[model samples]
Target chain A: MKISHAICLSAALATAPGLAFAQDFEAALKARQGQFRIMALNLGVLGGMAKGEVAYDAALAELAAENLETISELHQAPLWPEGSDNMAIDGTRALPSIWDDRADFLAKWDAFGKAAEQLEEVADEGQSALGPAVGAVGKACGACHDAHRQPSS
Target chain B: MTGGQRLSSDDLSAAAGDGDAAAAEQVFWAAGCASCHAAPEAEGDALLTLAGGQRFPSDFGTFVAPNISTDQQVGIGGWSFEDFATALRNGVSPQGRHYYPAFPYPSYAHMTDADIADLWAFMRTLPADQTPSAGHELSFPFSIRRSVAVWKWMNLDDEFVLGAADTESLARGRYLVEALSHCAECHTPRNAFGGLVKGRWMGGAPNPSGKGSIPNITPGALDWSATDIAYYLGTGFTPDYDSAGGHMARVVQNLARLPDGDRQAIAAYLKALPPVAPLDGGG
Candidate 1:
């Protein structure tokens, strides 16, 4: 019985790393997608105001901008583990170049962070100020997306 | 003015004089010269450098954009007005070689002589980079330069796809799309021979990179309002707030420089297109 128990323990130990890796892949993909979803939600609020699709409320705009800024500041490295690219997994729009060209990728993230900070500063200023700020943030988003993300399906 | 004919100095004499640099700037943006010629990820004034080393990979091969900057040694600076016009209108280089269709001279073939002259003048004013052009890495017969003449013979035509633009805006939009912008080059599906499938006009294709598919922008596929489309062109934001990704971001950068009315005209033209079904699960 002890030998059987030892055998079972060894088997579980052998599979543990592979199982953990699968979980990590799924978790990382979900985390990154969740972050993008949150960013999109907040951007939608600002975009609506900029386009006059919705009435501009200083409070709402400020809140959305702050949310974007806060989210952009998160330690996103954990959500972009090396093998979590679309080539390695399904349901991800993240391209392999994100890993292959990591320095440029990180630089784009920094740009988006700067743009978000700028948006947070000027979002409540007025509709005119908000429009350009929102545009800057959008461009920053695109600057990264253009080179990194897969096209929308 | 044929597909493989080189323009003579006499043929270009009418346009040899100074072109309107101001108007030419508009043509530059419309032609999206910087989209391929500019170094990857170049922005701001760096976009004006036009150093040209972007790589476009397709089934045929990888085509590297040539340096069109004013560097006399490696770029087109030494080429005459006739050389420039012939390359644009006839898909032939000054060296008496046929240029591959990947340059999109097929669409440029429809460009008016004045626009070509204006574009040339604007390009002359830009900064020069001395980067030597990398040749295309094509497969088999495609590697042969002479083979391009056959491809050009089969595919080169200047006919506009849209029959008539009832409105002035539509006419302008048609010119921008069918001639200057070469939107169909990416959005339209291509055949086995790499010729555009005109029947699938604006029907998105599998990306030449073989990653994601290009979206079909025809009226059937794109549900965005004209305002939304124009806004997306200007700001790179979709109606749902998702930003333009991939090569479209570069296109947005170019289109955004145009007047709002131009973006709206493009949107109007897109809306006017017959809804082509997405190319069989491609988009």
Candidate 2:
């Protein structure tokens, strides 16, 4: 009976609404941030090449663009479960509007994906083509950020 | 000039003639009309439509951007050049009522008659939206329209904050930052009366919307090279590859449309500024 009581106590703790949700979303938030860091790293490489800050290499540009395209296509739904917004969670800049305006958010995600695909297709062609492609991707990033993310103080 | 004063009849006659639309297009972009007048979240060509329902919340009240589109019935399309000039430079409406400073005419008040006329001409060319203007929501005393004249009397001036520009680029940058872009409107801190604290020129301020603080662009605070500043202005990308977010993204969209040299000029001007620390740092 003591062992059964201990088991029930553990189960109750695990199912507690506030504690459980916070623990679950902490991991999701970390993963989401990690994914964005990776994207930024690859985007930096492509951006450097386009800006001529780094020598243009057809192979390197292709690799960076492909990485971005792959990441953009990932199914990120699980990472953005409800109640994980900045209003409910600290240290995250994802505003509550992302959940309130889910349709618009998803559309922006799709637009970013399309822009990444276009960037990948033309990245290896030449630096001239890469310039505009990178700009389009940058604009797509800004569009969503303007609507969904909080500004850095 | 007193509040509610219209342009003189001579000035009105001068502005009545056809303005140089080509030149005005530059003024349109420089003045950043679309940043507030365009529909919120608008992108690309849609930004040119001055439908104006964006709401700005402040300590006093929520100020709604009114429709400045060329719609004859709902917008300023039917207003004479004198009316438009007065509104832009004098902070008075066509109805002889004083306008709130949220419209940023305090900066535009320094605009030359030629630039104002040109801006009017360029505005006339844009597509008109049928949307009606929205009234501002304000608290008492502040809600009283007549109270603005007192605020105007205390704060309004056409003086340039910086001394004479030694170089042509510096001159251009001063015009853009001071009169056209009105960068200080956000970057400079304000007193309890909402007047800009001229002593702390480019020092950062509490974001009037109460979200975050606007950064200090003085040389002491922003250490980015001129090229970095210009590049960031054009592409919205920082040196670290982090993109500009929030309202600055819209600012980038407008600046990108300008000639490359204009961005460089702005960079040069910023670099030449005396460094002023942010107020929170005990400035």
Candidate 3:
């Protein structure tokens, strides 16, 4: 009885990591997509205000800007693990190029973060300056998407 | 006005070369002449020197821009206005040889005689460089200039590729975009023979630079409003505060040179385009 209990415990310990790793991968994928969706939603609000499609409200703009700035600051590097690319997983548009060119990807991400910070800083500048600030942020996002993210319909 | 006959190509060329510099300058930027004709790294006043040695990479191969500066030997300086008109409207070199479509003359074919003359006049003012342009590096079947004749036969038409614009603003936008800027050359999809796939106009396609795909600007793909589009053209930023980069960064610089109204017009036109779902990745 003592030998059987020891064997069972050892086997459970041996196989546990593999099962946990699979779950971790799925969670990472969900986190990655979730982050992008949040970013897009925040961007859309800011975009509408910038284009005058939606009336400029300082409070709303600041909120959107804050959201974007926070998202940009998030530690997203872990979300893009090796097998998270579209080639490795379904429902993903992250190209393998992101992994292949990790340094460039990080640089672009840094640029985006800087742009987001700029947006956050200028959010209170009212309608006049916000348009251009928002544009800067959009361009930074586009720069990363152009090189790293695969386009989806 | 002799016998009410149209002015000869020589007469038009001479008159145009002496025409209003300011108006011609507007056409110069509107037509994006400096983007290709200017030296690759040229900036400031050097952009006015159309020495022409830019390399455009495509699926077929790399194409080197030719000298259009007023150098008598190596450039079009010595050519008559008719020569210039022929090159723009027909994609034929002054020597009667077929020019590669890389010059964007297919769209230029729809340009008015007045705009052509104005543009030709402006080209004559540029400082000429004596250097001969570099050769194109294309695959066997593509390397032959005569082969372009066949391609032109199938693709080249004098009529507007898209339908006529309904409103006056739309018309202006269409003229600037379709004829002068030729945005579709990069934005639209291409067929197996490297011809523009008309149905997918402005749908965005793979980057010929082999980096990634271009974004779809049609309403279906891009959600930016007219103001946003104009802001982007003038400032190189998306409505969401992303700045334009890559080749488009250069294009935005050129567009920024235009007047505010012109950029607005372009934005209006983009907003008016029919929505098209992106067929593949990369917008």
Candidate 4:
């Protein structure tokens, strides 16, 4: 019983509470996390494929590529999870500058998301493309994390 | 120098005093200053910024390189020679404030007394600093002076020294790359408390500037020829002909000016390091 892209997209549409045009950030952040998780998985699976390093290579690659496409779609659709707990953890590799500079982080994230989409273009070519594709993804991760995410000191 | 043998303090002072410039020179050579702060070619375009570069990036943020030249106003012109030595030996400023370990004072503290003096002697002769030093913008707990002193007292040593070297070339290389150049502090990623994760030596992290990842240079040699690595350090162009960009551009410029042998030796040592596990592996 393979769930098709139509069904997955439909699931996203139907699950939303309403206000299709509404920027209900809480829902958007939830949605975006889902997307990044999928994208991360996409890179992982493709990396695995490049090395021929795992079982179920074809299946994993297919699922990963598919997720990569969806993740790219949802990029920038979520940020700053609304109504989220503010229990801030200390000793964060995160610098105080980020909170002070939200606009810059968002702008960089937007650019990062766009570059991430290019990964799908390379990835769609097939597993042989993964090693370089991952490099592209690594660049995006670095660019954003440099501006936003704290290094795990 | 490893195997727990350090020159006696008196031997080092005596070497400098007795005008045995060779022993004094050996100490200076071992400390790794010529690795970066080179004497200007008499071409009249003296390279005034004898310090490593205009800026260095770390887990915290980017720090600008200070002018090491003996120039009085712009550089440490007002200081006694001993003041300069204390900065290197104890990671303190000429003003007696904490010198951040970002200067690699953690490893440099291992330098012996005589070696430090010679290095200072060498620094005094540098093209004097025209580059004004940038003050750091550290956060609250970090900005405090006493805490830095405590960090120095505990985590840093004041002795001019290094961890014992084993193989001679390897020892020489380590002295240059690690202690003197403070390569590991940047090239290696840090743990949560901002300490170098030793096992991952030279495994680069995203520079604190939030610009780009300095590619892991431990396994970095495999991606290029030894000459290519040396050449890039010397000239900024990889063998691929692609120029290294961003913050590394400055580092390459500094490296390019170094003595040829120093560049080659550093490359050889970096190439020989064990490849650490990559952190970005997909699940």
Question: Which is better, 2 or 4, measured by TM-score?
Answer: 2
Instruction: Point out the worst 10-residue segment of candidate 1 chain A by lDDT.
Output: A15-24
TM-scores, all models, native as reference: 0.89, 0.89, 0.67, 0.51
Best by lDDT: 1
Q: What digit string (tens of lDDT, one per residue) describes model 3 on residues B200-270?
A: 88998888877678888899888877877887786665654445655676577677667778888877788
Candidate 4 Cα errors over 4 Å, as ranges:
A1-153, B1-46, B49-74, B110-115, B126-134, B157-166, B220-223, B281-283
Best by DockQ: 1
Local accuracy by lDDT, each model: 0.86, 0.85, 0.77, 0.54
Please give the lDDT score at residue B27 for candidate 3.
80
Give the worst 10-residue stretch by lDDT in candidate 2 chain A.
A15-24
Candidate 4 per-residue C-alpha lDDT over B89-171 given as tens digits, one digit per residue, 9 for 90 to 100 = 66666666766666676777555565666666555555665655556656666666567665654455333223444666666
lDDT of 4 by residue, A43-126 (tens): 656654553455435555656666655655553524443222122322123344445666765665666566556655665566
Model 3 DockQ, alpha carbons vs. true complex: 0.14
* Order by lDDT, highest first: 1, 2, 3, 4
DockQ of the candidate models in sequence: 0.61, 0.59, 0.14, 0.02
Model 4 is docked with a DockQ of: 0.02
Query: Which runs in model 3 stand beyond 4 Å of their true positions?
Result: A1-153, B1-19
Distance from true position, residue B87, model 1, in Å?
A: 1.0
Clashes of 2: 0
For candidate 1, lDDT tens digit of each residue in A1-153? 657755664676597643233345877878888898899899999988887889989999999999999988998789898877776555688989999999999988988899999999999888878877887887888888988898876
Positional deviation of residue B267's Cα in model 2 after best superposition, in angstroms: 1.5
